[model samples]
Target: MPDNEETLVDVRSLHHRLVRINRVLRLAGSGSGLSAGTAAALWSITQHAPLRLSRLAEIESVSTPAISRIVTSLESMGYVERRADPDDARARLLYPTDAGRDVMSTARNARVLRLAEALDRLEPADRDMVERAFEVLSDALVPPEA
Candidate 1:
């Protein structure tokens, strides 16, 4: 087995490569006319709809004001809606609209297609190794419930 130092170096290298890959994918898939922040906000809302603004901010690790602005822009674009929170009359819950889901879906598909094309260029064994590596990493990040 590799030593801890060797594993750390490999992990750091993988992290840097993944970051670059994500940036390229984002640029290639940014046809929805949304900034990265806005797109991420929309995706987050879709995943956890009916979320409070403050909660969304916490989940996204952004300030409430930042989330508020993004929500406002999405609302104005008809991609998201603010509905009254039944539990709190003064509070509003954010939900993604059909348009928002469509936009996110399209953007995700574009990015995946671009990635698929790149992966297709790799040797089958190399591609298989990449796929298995991702599976292992994903399992490590979020292990299945016992």
Candidate 2:
């Protein structure tokens, strides 16, 4: 294993690279007219439908009012809707509309295509190395329950 200083240096380099990659991916995937926060909230709603706004705020690490604004934007765009929670009439659940799912699908396809184009430039061995490295990092970073 490397010394602490070496590990820190490598980690910093990895962070920089990941940030750049994320920026590229975000641009590629954001063909939708929605802002980043609004797009992200819609995607999350699609993934975890029938969930409370409070839970979504927690998941997104934003305040309730902030998420509420995003959700309002989404609703205006016809991307998301709120339904009375079956368990509690006082609480409402968020669900993505069909239009919302279509937007997300289109965005996801664009991002995948962009990434695939980049990966295609690499040699087969380098591509394999990237895959292995991604797997290792994902396993290390993700919680066991996740």
Summarize candidate 1's per-residue lDDT along 15-59 as a digit string, tens digits: 899999999999888999999999999999999999999999998
lDDT for each residue of candidate 2 in 1-146, tens digit (9 for 90 to 100): 45799898998999999999989998999889777788888889999897999999998889999999999989998999999999999999999999999999999999999999999999999999999999999898887883
- The runs of at least 3 residues in candidate 1 whose Cα sits more than 4 Å from the true structure, single-residue gaps closed, are 1-8, 143-146
Most accurate candidate by lDDT = 1
Candidate 2 CA-lDDT value: 0.92
Predicted model with the maximum TM-score:
2
Deviation (Å) of 108 in candidate 2 = 0.5
lDDT, each prediction: 0.95, 0.92
> Could you report the Cα RMSD, in angstroms, for every candidate shown?
2.4, 2.0
Off by over 4 Å in 2: 1-3, 144-146
Model 2 quality (TM-score): 0.93
- Taking all chains together, each candidate's TM-score versus the true structure is 0.88, 0.93
